[model samples]
Target: MVRGEDRHPSLSLHLRARQTAEYRASTAEAERQLRDNDPDARPHRLQHCRGLRESGCNRVLGIINLENFERENAYGESELRLLTTIAASLGTALENARLFDETQHLLKETEQRNAELAIINSVQAALAAELNIQGIYDAVGDKIREIFKNRDMGIRVYDPKTDLIHYAYTYENGKRLSLESEPLGNAGFAAHVLRTRETLVINENMTQAMTKYGSYALPGTQVEKSSVLVPMVAGEQARGIISLSDMEREHAFGDSDVRLLQTLANSMSVALENARLFDETQRLLKETEQRNAELAIINSVQAALAAELNIQGIYDAVGDKIREIFKNRDIGIRVCDPKTGLIHYPYTYENGKRLSLESQPLGQTGFTAHVLRTREALVINENMEQEVAKLGATLVPGSQMERSLIYVPLVAGDQARGLIGLMDMEREHAFSDSDVRLLQTLANSMSVAL
Candidate 1:
């Protein structure tokens, strides 16, 4: 019961310690006096003339001295009885105080745990924004480590072809594995669990008589004492297996532990599947965007081949094409006429970040002009040295950040309309292939706008 005696915060213990110290000192003084001339009534020698006073206060505990303790000048029966009564009354109060302390401690622990869980939830949500395979795996495994107190956990991605299990990521050894082989192969409990796609529990005694899973487990990877293994399944397909190794405790895991692992695995499975699909979607979107961008460039070139009937028409036609394909609003057609080296023909600005006809020029002044001269499309960081300041021409006072931008040039035989620029406002998010193709095609269309 005194497992945490050193940590006890009882006011009673302090009082008792103080009282015992005082009593020991007094007894020593009494014994020293007894050694002197008066041994029989030594107590009388020291206290014969002392005045005693009693204070009015609610008493709790009572202490009883033995009958023969008078040799030590101890209390009489009445006083002993009173001490007993005090102790009796204080018993219930002490018990209640202990209970209240325990409850308060438990409540504090629960609140701290709740705060930790909230942080984990936020991390998981942030992970959700990522749609990459490795990113998803890292996120899931990281989350598993965190939920399980960031201690011991293992993962083996399913190999449908080889039909074997191997470690995907292990929160073990800081890369200094206790088990052999960096990636655990088909052998011990891991293989057994993964091969069967079944749940395994090694509550206590990790690497023991695991006969049934002998063929399934990692060689010598034994359960040791306590561990839990669960198969990670996604879309009815086994994607991987999660293994948790227990550290120093009886009944290392319980039903709640099992349920929690299963729940996290399920979420991880779904998240992995979603990430893969999103990656594929991104690929598809890229291809489509590339094709559209090419067609737009072609259209711009062809339009330039014709006379500039209505520069606004060319600008609108191409700009609308870009908005439809790339989902961008900052689009404009710039022309390079031997008559006028630079000209900006516009349709409409969007996303509330418009292009200033006065300051921010379209062609080479932006990415489009550079592309026109080199006949190469240009993509640049939206927050470069010069652009950082020029951005103010379009953005609000303290907000100058966009994702990325691209520019394509229109060439008509020997002549070319300066260039066309398109932009979006989510950095590190590059323009899609379809967007490039569409812009190129629109560049082809800008000659007439010139």
Candidate 2:
């Protein structure tokens, strides 16, 4: 029996007569000529060339050929009827075998498909549980390796703002590989997938695929014989690529393999987007809390200073609030008397100890006079010694050298009436921009209270 255009005989049964050797040789020659499609080959002599068609169908299941009969009309009508009966039975049996084989094939494919679906479900579950990008990479990478049974797999993240591709996760021969970011120019399979937002499967001739796509490979990876690249797309935008490769086998992946990975890649893209949203929400929540806390601090300080009626009482209230706001105990308030060219420090604390000093003349030099004259705030977190010297400011006789400080002027209408200064002696860069803004707000309230 032979099937289709490539007529290679699949089954043969022999029934030998007296001229068996001659008969077999002739049958072999006929089969070869037919297979080769030789136009000049003659039809068999005394052979029943009628095709054995399946019942009620024109489809030829097999052929019954009888060559080199011992005599002309060796057997009569009875013999022909017997041969026809035999051919009918043979055709029926052949058709049954073919159907059985097809049924088995379909069953196997269904089972394989069910297994792949289960694996995809498991991967989706794992990805959904992860709240960070790195966790999503791990889940997708592991599932890709398991499905393809390939040790080399990678998940690349593309940053459109930078036009760079970063290998967030990679494995080579079941071992982890660390990689750096590269420009996502018109090169490499990963870049191609990201640019087009399409899936690529290279089952053979990887060099051809590379040439057709772009002839570039990652710096730290080995050349692969077969590979598949699927873009991780969410909505209309592609975020990255998921890639799997085999170093030793050609045709290692097929259409089904590409489909499975593409499904998994889609799930990964959703998970990554969710993780980004989660992180952004967390950051915004924290900023709101910080702002609320700063407002509360300002309100509390204003209430405390408002309750004091005298300048001395206000200075004491500010000192108490400053201590609560800052870790350092070095703080002071200087009130300027414009008519007398004098500045008085009614409140000064250094290392938790209060100091009493006489009022000094507001001279042409020193940071105190500069702030009073200009009504501008100053912040010094680095090169404190040089900054103080540049401003012609002198340190108190028994105080520690200040490393970080903020000085804000207290202004009323067009004139700055006083100054509030805080210093940290132990650390540089101890104040942030937010801290400066907070102090300026407090200074405004303090100016009103005065």
Candidate 3:
């Protein structure tokens, strides 16, 4: 017999029996006829069948066939009932197995989702405590190490000011190294990831990877096996990149692992942005405080400069005002005579004592002399000896003279009249730009007072 366009022997008999929902008890004569119809096919002398229908849908699953069953005597009614019962039991067993497999698959998927959620929650908690980008990187790196058990990790940040991406953190073999690199001109995998904003996972021998994609190997590190690169993207901008490598070639960073890391990467981008915003807020607050302090000092000095006119009163008021602002005891003001090219230290205050006033030739030599000549402010924190040697000017070494010094030229009506000299005997970088500018303004006010 034939089913559709294909010829079959006993198989067609079995199928037809199932389609009609009837039992087929074929004999030798039927088998002979089937063989004659399809000589190439195998013919069963006895083909006994019963339809096995699913209980849920009442749809026939297939036939439970007894091929080549020898029945010497006539079949009994009890035997046909046994065959029908066996077919029904087989159908139920098949359905149960299908349901069991489906249940197992669903359970595995649920567990996987749960694990991913747990990782995200843990990372988010860690991120909440970070106020800076480095802290965020550290927290994320720690979590990555915990979950992946691989210390070969790196996080980079894109610096728009420099137009370069720099490595913020890199961990390998229990050591944290300070490393910086640029993401320019297809430098390496990190650069590629940043530019493309794509996640790349390669679980292969490092040598092979390098051979295949030589342009992707990072510059500094010697690779042994595998790597995963995930871009930290916030909205449409690619902010940075994270790279994790494994020494073992056959690493377990499968499809699911890549997905989990991508999710974490997204979270990291948001966390980094938040940290940056927080840092910017703190910086703005600090700037506001500094500006307020500067304004207050300027106001006090303006009042003092306005109230006092005599040289002695002006000197005393200027000394008090500078002391109040700089909080430094070693402060002095000199008046420059353009006629004689001389700088006269008319007022010098140090440690609550007044130094005997002295005068020296302003021969375009010392730091103060240079300020007088150029009419510019100078801040020096190192190489004091070089300035001293270059200028060939005489200076009284005070009790609190230090490496760092500031010289602000006092000018009035476009003529350099005098300058103020201050020394930081305690620390370097102590005199900030704001301090210098404030003192310069005060010196100009003093010049007018003079």
Report how far residue 276 has shifted in candidate 2, in Å: 5.3
Which candidate ranks first by TM-score, i.e. highest? 3
| Candidate 1 vs candidate 3, lDDT winner | 3
lDDT by residue for model 3 (1-450), tens = 432323232233233324343233334434454458676754334345566656666656656444432333334578569878887887787777778999998886785565556546655665566435566567667776666665577778887667777777787656777765664555556556777899978786656656555454346655647778899898787888777766655674677667767776776677667666776786688667656555665566566667765666656666766776677557788888788877777677665567766577777566677787789998877776676677674556544455677888888888888888787666666677666766776676566655
Ranking under lDDT, best-scoring first? 2, 3, 1
lDDT of 1 by residue, 156-197 (tens): 676666665556566553332433433435666656665677
Which TM-score value belongs to model 3? 0.53
lDDT string for model 2 (1-450, tens) is: 322223222233333323333343433464554446644534333434434556776555545654332334444677558777887787677778878999998886785565456545655565467435566567657766776665688888888899988898888766889888988888778777887899988889888878887766677777888888899898898988888878889998878777767776776677666665675686687567556545555555566656644657657766666666665457888899999988888888876778887788889878888888899999899998798789998765556678898889999999999898887778899888767776777688667755
Computed on alpha carbons, the lDDT of every model, listed in order, comes to: 0.55, 0.72, 0.67
CA-only RMSD, every prediction: 16.3, 12.8, 10.3
1 or 3, greater by TM-score? 3
The local distance difference test score of model 2 is 0.72
Model 1 TM-score on a 0 to 1 scale: 0.37
Residue 397 alpha-carbon offset, candidate 3, angstroms = 18
Where's the lowest-lDDT run of ten residues in candidate 3?
Answer: 4-13
**Best first by TM-score, ranked:** 3, 2, 1
Judge candidate 3 against the unseen true structure and give its global Cα lDDT, from 0 to 1: 0.67
